[model samples]
Target: MKKIILGSLFLCASTAYADRVDNVQTEGVLSSQITMTVADITCHINQGLGISQQIHIPTISTNDLRTGNTKSVEVPLMVDCQASNDQPGSIAIHLVPAGVSTVSGDHTITTSLDSVGLELAWKDTSLPALIIGNTEFTPAQATNNVWDLSLIARPVLLAGKNVTEGNYNASLAIKVTYY
Candidate 1:
């Protein structure tokens, strides 16, 4: 019988793969971290939405503040720096006055009509009196990075009292720093 039917069909395919079986399971693990920084210099004031710039003192007549005659307005300070290789260092300017602090000490800065106050000079009169919160160090008439400041806002009569006609305002804040 053909060699006993091929030895019983190879013994039923080796007992059907020796009754098969296999199973596995195992999992977990992952991570991360990074940091960076780079800066040589950068500055932007009066042109960075810091209220841009505005000053307009004209109509004054408490007999022109009793014959002292005052009226000055021109507060323009534009600083734009970006140094890396051009090397623009040394620039510190800060004049913050949102009112109050007037007896004319820190160069006045208080107005809403209370004997009127607003005197912050530096029209090249040896550049030095712009102190309201103090942080002066301005001497950059023409650097490649730019820093042009020619400010003067006068309308002082603080403490002379009794010169109120109503409606007078003052508010200033400009701070720039670079090393």
Candidate 2:
């Protein structure tokens, strides 16, 4: 009789337990677009200036460098600003020289010719000549916002230095400011 009562009590306890359940739901959305824009000034290669060019230098003996020498080549600076901004906006131009010189108001021109010190200058037809690391704001010609400025690359030798015979090359960075 005690066993029967114990079995009945165990069955009742098992039935007294309860069950639990849980659930979750979620939703997400992402919709966006991106756009990029530039300033109202553009550098273009309509002719010869916008591209790399080689200027021939006058041959000189080692002693000639003591007095300094100059070599120059003519090129055109073409730019398209017709639709660059609202109306015919103005622009500013400057040049940064590529060299290893640390002298104030002086820049270097990296070239294959070793032991030779050289300087570069930009001669605009409408403005005074600007050396490397200089800025200027003068337009040579503009028609409907198409700028056609004339430029000359003038390289001069540093005094009291000797230059070996070889070809030298350097690229100038042109910075344009628009208003």
Point to the candidate with the largest lDDT.
1
lDDT of each: 0.65, 0.53
Residue lDDT tens for model 2, 1-42:
879999999998766642322232345687889896554454
C-alpha RMSD by candidate, in order? 25.5, 22.3
Per-residue CA lDDT of candidate 1, range 73-130, in tens? 7777766664444334466667776654443566767777778887777665634455
So what's the TM-score on candidate 2? 0.49
User: In candidate 2, how many Å is residue 1 off?
Assistant: 99
For model 2, state the Cα shift of residue 84 in Å: 4.8
By TM-score, who's the top model here? 2
